[model samples]
Target: MFNGKFLTPCFKSKQPWKRLLSTQPSVVLAMSGGVDSSVSAALLKQQGYKVQGVYMRNWDSLDEVGHCTSKADWEDVQKVCSILDIECSQVDFVKEYWNNVFEKTLTDYAQGVTPNPDIGCNSFIKFGSLLDKIPEGTWFATGHYCRTNNGKLLRGLERNKDQSYYLSTVPEAALRRTLFPLGEIESKVKVKQLATDFGLLDIAKKKESMGICFVGQKRKFASFLQEYIDQPPGPVIDLDSGKVIGQHEGLYGYTIGQASRICHGSHKWFVADKLLDQNKLVCVAGSNHPALFSDTLVAKNWTWIHHQIPTLPVQVDAQVRYRQSPEKAILSQTPDGQYALRFTHPIRAIARGQQVVVWDQDWCLGGGVIDAVL
Candidate 1:
């Protein structure tokens, strides 16, 4: 039920990866009871490598209402560990999750930003805390559809499976020790076939995760942080007329370029920007105007994978959301000491504070938090 078709915006992925097993990589597999990691562990084992499957004790509260908790994923990991016949362990990242990923995400939301938690999860927990448990020579691995070239980050296998965009912020040190076994393999369909070939359970048949991994679907965002997040009601202003159209429950609850959940939908509205100073939602009714969207965007917090940043601004493509194509753009350094990227074609709803990943061909140059639009 969870894997049923839902609203998927455009995402960028690699064409498929080829991982040679010559190294006999000793890896720590991050298992989520899903197909991707299941197959990754299976492949590592088939190649005669030492593999360990570890289920993350995520930050979701044990007392959280509804389907968000430890029981389901825990049981699934246990079952998968038995099937894979690999060493399995559990690690509690609740404290680190709250401090590093959760707070940073909610804080960005409060500032009228849509921060990607996967970025934080990779940089902090999965690669940070989970990797710490493995031995010195062992590499950390995941179920993600991404790849690396000579320890440098690249697009993963399956053009539809690329996840490098979410990892723009991952440090180079981590990339050196990271492995994506599923990066070059076929889709989950083939992964399922391989599972059957190996006498393993049907991991792909299990429902895919929707929304936040720890937070189950349709649960109010506020409930996750009753102690930390505060929802502040604000006015929804008309962008063209500059008049108030409706009242929003909280400025922090919405993201730039969102179309759903508008209080007043009699007239179509798109979030142009978040007016945090005024605590208002600045929205446009009909967005036929080119000026409303962006062709060039500047992202802060820039980091490159395995390569020094170019002194000259590089020509590349970028994506504002997951599953989106990397739009053609030119990169430049602004006077403010941050990077600026002007796209070949203007992209719709280029929200400030959302993620912007830049790619030079299949090689990942880097990405940053969007700070301005033009």
Candidate 2:
């Protein structure tokens, strides 16, 4: 159970549950057996909406032992649905996820670019594949920490837990039907308490999922990557002194800004860049190295949630990665239709292939894939 911190629930009116039983719309919730999605189902039930819970099995045994963790998750989903007295269903999206998400992820790393599979999974699997599979006329919901106002995507009330960045590239039409029951909750701790209050003690205490999508908690991602791609040892070069300082297992094993894995002494080194053509890994001494900072970046495959690109040179808050605060920047499209972002101050370790999500106050303006750091 979450540490006790009381906050008023989203529905302030008395007997909100009564209305849902009468005429409220029915919704199909994508339950992942996590606390956030659990609370979503409880809230929908509380609001009197006829709810059906669907757990997506996106990864199977072929992914690696204990990688999927679907068994435990499905058990939780069943428990939650039973408590709520709702029907639960499971779908196998293993083929779709492998082709659309997992394959592209390996391809990105092999090319020396770090990609965000979570972002792609939200677009292609959760919203794309699942939505297509659900029966027609069924409204959808998920545990995503984002808001939709008038068919537009908005940042969740909780700044730290806002998941708008991942959902930024999802189809606008998907946003139109999807509901985030936890959108207005300001804290994850509060969500846990809400679950506890609703008698979902197990889910309230469930640990958060991290690293690559579908991978079990505490699994080493670098080791997992090796299963698919060869990590050939290569020289780690110093960007400033232009000398070979150490050797890396492979360029694929490291990411920009990652602590230098080859360093063995008091001096610390960090990944600054990669030379894919020459098969070299570039490292710079110290965390404050100028080589790690960039004020400009080029992002391709721009996806604007509103389905319209913003005018040139508009100022907004740009987030290069999840959990990082959005920095002030000017966003504009390149002549070739890709987008560029120039931060008011230099940002550090802007990795290629990561998403650069933008926002105008509370509204998520959508984002594009980072093509280069200039």
Candidate 3:
């Protein structure tokens, strides 16, 4: 139990700050100016804990187009901080992002795979990159809906909305210091109530951001690849004849499951494979391409949060993307410590650079950047 002052105002109001501060633990809130984070900040202040807002300024290349990371978000964050009566600081992570996170992701994507950047942002930037700035004994909290029990990360109360996949890469070292304030709450109605009750309704009804990912409404993967990964122009081949049917701008820019983008005379297409050796982009038209789906995925940059890789025949559930359902799998660990997941059912186009989050049921076992889909 916290030995600080009596929970006079805090216990009465059911604010987390009062609940957490009975032990006098200082807290730093990653305020994004959204209603959820705003409510978090407000509740923390009302409970009388030492609270401050730390907004991470990420790389959106806003100066180039003169937009994005919009002013509205900043203004909203400022308003919330004013209401909460706390100091706000902007932390720069652009350098670390490119050097520590982005560099490695692009390398994986060049070989033809789907990469999720939010994993890096969560594991490295939002958590790993900000440790030193927090005052001694202060714990770090974010607007994430997930929860952690005594430093053991767990799924959120809202199963449909869990972000554990992206957050699955957080190292154990950073996990010990992190807190998730929104872990136990339901989404939508409850979130609105929190906003309405706190007199932040104007912005409370606002839609939440997807995170620091730089994608746009359309598929930005092409542009992302063009900027970071080089794609030499190559021949688009007919799978049967292995003859050149058309041309593609770059072979590295395509994935196993994507077909509509390739201009193959509207015959319908399924990517069979990217043959860098043959310098050809292979596709099957209006038919099954069994080779595209793989029963196993070769995952590199393997990370085990709770413990090291389990012994052979390790039981784990693997997810290719945040929304994908969990798949039963066996992980084979290499002598060098890299691991590959062999799924019971073949997963479609298990791309090269996408992150693979393995779970031991509700507990996020850990994750890593997808190295290859073998």
Candidate 4:
């Protein structure tokens, strides 16, 4: 199904899939009905591991247009499992997801801070509740584009599609039992090719999902959030002019570095900050305004994958958001015992409540939540 032009680079860089021998023989894979997971199941079966697929039903409601997205995905899972000769089942985690991930996300937004729900889902749902519900001693596997080396989290071979950032919050114990079959695959193009070879042409051509799973592609994020969170309107003020430019429906609708849609003027206005006490949305005139950048940030709830904190003032590559290149920074502990990251150069749009994942070359050291921007 891949174009010839796209397959050339993938073929050149493709490496032999290393066959792993498992002492436990049985594996439980989290199948999301995506090409990545489908390929992972095939690879696991090829390795002689008895595979069982479990589809997590995290969101129970229909999409904005009254379409049941989860139902369609489950149907795909059944088709893939039938081809692979593996048993498949579904688990209901809707209540757990609401309490652990969604509730905390709404709370962060209501407080005028940006939060990453996908990070929370990985930490709390996939690695937390799912692990607890599964039978003990059964090795767990997923389609995550990451690797675990001797209980240490490692970046996948595909640098552009590496997903170690989302799994930074997962505990070390969880990593020890996890298997990532797609970790060594050179590119997503190769994954799709492998899926087609495994007789999963429909899944191989399926579009890659983005953003939060609960918020469907057809839905407006702000409108979906407003249905659950009750927020009042606030004033939108120009940062440079110090004048009220317009009114915002709610502070939750805007995030730092996002373009302000309500404020129309000669210059495009970007959200610079949120004045929570005064309930004001500060907007800067230009996209590259100095107010949008910060050289340092304070993060709390620090978690190391190996459960061992690093020495102070250590230099490493860090990223404030997913898909962003990791930048050089020094991570040190403050005198008051809080952890802080000081970038070698200024970083842009370091938002509060978002995560800061650090890496030491190919190894993911782990990360923390951005509590304050300095």
Q: Taking the candidates one at a time, how many backbone clashes does each contain? A: 13, 1, 2, 0
Top-scoring candidate (TM-score): 4
Query: What local distance difference test score does each model get?
Result: 0.72, 0.83, 0.70, 0.85
- lDDT tens digits, residue span 246-358, model 2: 88877777899989777645779999999988889998889889989999999999888886657788999999999798899999878988999999999998999999999
For residues 1-374, what per-residue lDDT tens digits would candidate 4 score against the true structure?
11111111111123111112456377878899999999999999999887877788888777674344687788888789888887676777888899999999999999988999999998998899887665556789999999999889999998999999999999888999999999999999999999999999999999887646677767778988898888889888988888999999888988999888865678889999999889999999888999999999999998989866677789999999997999999999888777899999999889998999999898899899999999
Tell me the alpha-carbon RMSD of every candidate: 8.3, 7.3, 6.4, 8.3
Over the stretch 1-374, how does candidate 1's per-residue lDDT look in tens digits?
A: 01111111111201111122456666777888777788788888887777766677765554356666365776777677677666665656778888998879878877777788888888788877766655666777887888877757888867777888877777778888888888887576787787677666556577677667556655766566444667677788887788888887777776667663565657777777777888888887655544367787778887776666766677787888877977887888888878888888888888777788877788787778888877
lDDT minimum window of 10 residues, candidate 3: 2-11
Candidate 3 total steric clashes: 2
Candidate 3 per-residue lDDT, tens place, 278-335, comes to 6778887754567667887777777788755466768788898888888999877866
Measure candidate 4: CA RMSD: 8.3
Model 2 pairs in collision = 20-48
Better of 1 and 4 by lDDT: 4
* Model 3 TM-score (2 dp): 0.83
In lDDT terms, how accurate is model 2? 0.83
TM-score of each: 0.87, 0.91, 0.83, 0.92
As a TM-score, model 1 comes out at 0.87
